[model samples]
Target: MRNILLLICFALMSSFIQGQEILGDWYGSLQIQGTKLPLVFHIKKQDSSYSTTMDSPKQMAIGLPVAITTVENSQLLLEAPAMGIKYTGEYDHTQEIIAGTFQQGGLKLALNLSRDNFTTAINRPQEPKEPFPYHAEEVRFYNESDDISLAGTLTTPEGLEKFPVVILISGSGPQNRNEEIMGHKPFLLISDFLTRHGIAVLRYDDRGVGKSEGEYATATSKDLSRDTEAAITYLKSRKDLKISKLGLIGHSEGGIIAPMIASKSKDVDFIVLLAGAVLRGKDLLLLQKKLIEEKSGIHDSIVNRSQEVFHGAYELIASNTKTNDALKEDLAAYFKEETNNSINAAQTNSLIESMTSPWMQYFINYDPTTALKEVDIPILALFGKKDVQVPAIENALALEKLENKNIEIFQMENLNHLFQESETGMPNEYSEIEQTMSPKVLNLMLEWILERD
Candidate 1:
């Protein structure tokens, strides 16, 4: 569920004497693991200096400022200090192109930019248009425990005195209120459908993302549970929503967080888990790697060896006695040996850093069964048969072990993690799929919620 927007670079190099050549938009794509992430650089001349901003169309990130922009001798240097990104490229005047290498986080990749703006359009027909029938309002709420203000959208049916409400907990990432990814706004569409059917919905941005005010990188699952609790508190104060009917609808990691909150908080009456992970984080990730690799036609022997290396690394991290430095050194040695020294130091260090993050550490060690087993409220857990991230069979089986009469599990035939009707169910295909969410899943969820009461 964590959507990492890989940074793409576009260098606009031109002679200062003839700045007009680089004054417009330059387009390029960064090829990362078979995915072409489209990037657009909008450059403008301001007196003697130039200013530029970048847009990542695939990730829906726009107007990201370039901290330093310089052009001299038909060469360009664009640096974004915040993202640790730097691009240096030479301009070919006759070809109207810039050939460069984009470097960030110890990885260097080639990127070529052209004057012609070639945009890739993704069609998402389910995204709701403006002038929605329901009442949509921008709202803010406080998480007193963390002392941060979170912002989001609350959609309610018009003319309804009181209605059942559900707070939408986004998956693992710094998502906006819409849970937007690959140009699809699933949360907005879900809110629209639910609100239109007489259900009030609340969906907020991850802390430190969008309008929220908290540091995302430093927060853990426990910290996120507090934020969800705060959302419950905010809704309880509202007079137009039925407090007794309040529930939670969580996707991916959010699915895990919902049970964490509901196990203790009496406010949550029901919960809906969409593509939730029931297995421990380490097991879930290993299965995910195997499934995705197999689907990509990788050999079983290679996949098994890869899993073995990852398992060793995860085991080292799970041990509380190992210090961060020791863990990194051990993991690096293991990776080097497993890859026969083919993996470079920089890439190895990058992988180690990501694996050692606070979030990843907490996630790998945290087991959702402890929380799910304690949740006495009615629960509906849905999984997609083709979902590679959290395989439907394994997760659904894990949930079934809870044996809680209040819990109902369903594995859909052809849906993906995002609940979209998918082909291979790979993350790359999420953008290409025209459907935002399966209408059948939406109807099923709505019916389950309506029947709960």
Candidate 2:
């Protein structure tokens, strides 16, 4: 999965004509899939050169530096080499707009910037507000293994002296305590729901995000598992609250993590997985790419071709036969030949860098079947039938193969990866939908946990 943050393109400093009309802020809405994302380019004049910064208001990210910018002959080009984002457009003086196409990797979308401010009215009604019915406290804990302090919020039902508590583990991306994304705070809502029902919840920022202290970019899933281990250690030390039962509630990548911890840790009493993967990492990613590409309306021919290219690349990486440098060189050559030189060097480099990252390398080889089999605790795994990211049908089949009596797996009909009732279940539709999470999902979790107690 991509980062929960909407915009990845970062600023450009280049020589341009003086006193150009594109000097101020230019607003645009990048429509990907069905969701509309607002983007702003703050162009400024600096002596003989021009500097540009980008703002993604929806994601709360601003003042992002652009890598390259050029304007000449009523045409403008903006490129962020690191992110593989490139925009080439012509400034229409009559319409007072810059008609452009935004390209990143294999995806391309129309993005038109205008002088008028473009804003997407964000409505997330399910987010809990204060005068909350529970007791919430800001807490700090240390991951002794990493020697770093992590910050989070712990919420418990009012007047509960002893209770079962679960640590809320986020997905693949760097997320805050709330798992804030696309104007939605699913973790905040989840904590509120569970706490109101008499279960304590602890949700924290990923390392290097929000108030946490540690580097996230380089940390693999195994490293993140240590952070959760610290939270478990912290909960056990709280003699005042007396947490009776300690369980884990993990979503997406967290699903993979929950099993990793439960298989070895005697401290974990139970675990819940939301949209978890049952297949091997490489297999899951390949399936994810194919499903998403087909749903996005790409022709079968194109999807098949793209899938073949990615499959080859993933195989090379998984082989581990060559040094990192040699592997990168091989990947570069392979990609160039596969695409017939259609992809630019910057895009190829960005793709190679991501596929070769520590996390990607680990994920490509990870198989959670052994971990899942070793877990003796009660396990609850839920999947959205409409989820294209982790398709329920395939995972459910895999679960059937396990036949673990302690595990209970359900495929919720018509739900998406986020457990929201969805039609298409594409990532583009995640921000457009109003529901933070389906009430049915919340109720199911509550009932299951309460029954266990």
Candidate 3:
């Protein structure tokens, strides 16, 4: 799939002058096509130089302030090491607004700033136990794509007879080859286990992610599908490959992409869905809101407000609405209501903007349900009962809608979004828990691969 970033750039310019009290929270929405994306800049000015943070309400953990190094003319740049870099917002003195420019691979817009008070939480993904059961080597391959050759690792058994090969696909959100999310790298563990169990596995970094080429923020998951199809085509061309059968396995968003490739391609013989979605992404996000409320340990009133904010932002994105002054106001009001007595206003506004960015808008508009039901290959779908990221309970129903009965479903009772154990469904439980992949998932996948025709 081609990108739509360049075709959808409106005005996102702002004006700022010297000797001004830039110390305050600046808020505004970035526009991508018809949708309005929200964003916040918590500007902390200390004399001539200053530090600021650009954050997303959707991603609380990545909300750390970034140091600003150089400022020349109207352009201002901010760099946050742990996450990614952001270049946007012009200093505006005429309007007293720190206007939005380009962020998260979207258009530019101006933000109004005022001396506002707020608090924030800084989070780094915790390390967790390996997901797969066995040990395997990590290898990289590069080729295709005009930007950079895609790179991926190969995991094979110790003895290495040409064994059945399985190529892993990650869900969404700029994942590494291991599909690293937070602390757990499920693909790494899965490849380790499957290869050691007499299977060959290949998992790669998404293009523009991890040692791969291309700009990630400007790409789509459909692009990843094309990448996966390339990986499969590459494997088929190799003489090193063994066995008569080939397989494709995916987790979360990867699960959705797996089916897309299998449907059109002639090579993929078996498929595995690890917490894949069956519903439209927009609906799935609503379910995600509910999950977030439960996980955040919040009240019902707060939950309702959050839903409104999420849906409103979603409507703007799906319809590709032009972000105007009114859109920004609607967002700020929603965040104010949601964060009242809960999170700091600045932080809340940050989250709101981050979720509505151009790329995020597109992600929510894409659905995997239609594709999941169309793949004709043998499918093994697994869901942890505790999984909140891609609620298995809701996805389980999609199996009944498959075009054929070739799909097999397996649901594990205690697993959460990361396949980590959680009795009460709390996210912190993942850090407290061990073994991100259930032993049962390994057994089921391995057995299915061996038994499939």
Candidate 4:
């Protein structure tokens, strides 16, 4: 799961200036820990009054109401009290930019908004240009369990009479077949590389995303496994493709689901888990929060306090004893007391709603060990040494203790959750890195799969 606190705290920016064109969309990117998060400000003038809203495109949040907007002496100030965000800027007519600073809590970053919504184009050199080598097909399959149609791409080598096939399971969020994020299409590249190497690859949009049908916001990980099962069924039905072996290559939460299916299905021959969690979901999220905060240079005391707050909240959610309404009241009272009533009811409600969501509740309590142990098929689990979200040390050690003869684990050094060669292994550097995935990791996966084949 993505860090809810990080997203909420950083859903931030905006600006305007006196005597200049400011009644349009102004765009800029906030540089946080070497990560570029783009924000847009929609400004309009209404009968001698000015109003504005903010958008954080990177977070998929738009039209966030700005409580206050004002301009005086050619300087513009905007504030969103609910989110504790403030932006101050001055329009440089010659430069055609609103040069400013964005502040939220103790964090502040330089932001420059322009009429032209242009940021430096992120280079994705690894993305495939053309597809002459492999046969690529846009396909649709039915998730009969959910009564949803899922769309995806299937690629296979040209000359193979029968080919080994694997379904690519994306990590969290509503991803398309490409599993596109931060301008990186890891799944598409994986599909391309493996198909070119004679493995048939099937990757699809999440249930409610892209061309697929169904709702997404309410679905949990177990719900998503049904989609993967559907993909497996679809591949099995395509007997003309002559599949030699079937496997699953899952990243992050996908790693969790792969075992869930492989444990029950007789058809799965192998499974590859990338940064799968060995710790229970609750423990994993706690570790993730601490590591990310420390890496981002947050003070120790603050991190500890935040950890304490979330730990209690997760415990409450995990208890599963209260009705939804009762849980909300309890959570509201708990948060208010924990924060010394500094947080407003709206903020508390937002926190309560997110923590109590179907996905969150399921993830906090779900343990993959049972499924991992039951899966007798060959398993390859890889972790990035620098991955803070699913840090390798504890999880890798946990898997090692499992000592399942069928399970093999490896850790790649200096890599992040996305498997990109990273300096700090923070999510901020994902887009800045040009390589989609480390060649070493990719080669290892290929070699491992082919050897098993």
The model with the greatest lDDT is 2
Q: Write the per-residue lDDT of candidate 3 for residues 181-300, one digit (tens) a residue.
A: 434567877777777678888899887777777776656667667788878877888886565689988887788789888878888888988888877777787877677675666688
Quote the positional error of residue 367 for candidate 1 in Å: 0.9
Candidate number of the best TM-score: 1
Estimate the TM-score for candidate 2.
0.85
- Model 2 stretches astray by more than 4 angstroms: 3-27, 31-78, 82-120
Candidate 3's TM-score: 0.67
Backbone clash count for every predicted candidate, in the order shown: 0, 5, 26, 0
Residue lDDT tens for model 2, 168-272: 999886778998776789999999999999999999999988899999878999999999999999998888887878999999999999999999999999999
Name the lDDT value of residue 232 in candidate 4.
93
lDDT of each: 0.82, 0.85, 0.64, 0.84
Pairs in steric clash, model 2: 10-65, 11-65, 11-66, 11-67, 12-66
Model 1: per-residue lDDT, tens digit, 152-199? 999988887767899999888667899887778999999999999989
Off by over 4 Å in 1: 3-26, 30-72, 77-88, 91-97, 101-110, 114-120
Where does candidate 3 stray beyond 4 Å? 1-146, 158-161, 181-183, 321-352
Q: Which ranking of candidates, highest TM-score first? A: 1, 2, 4, 3
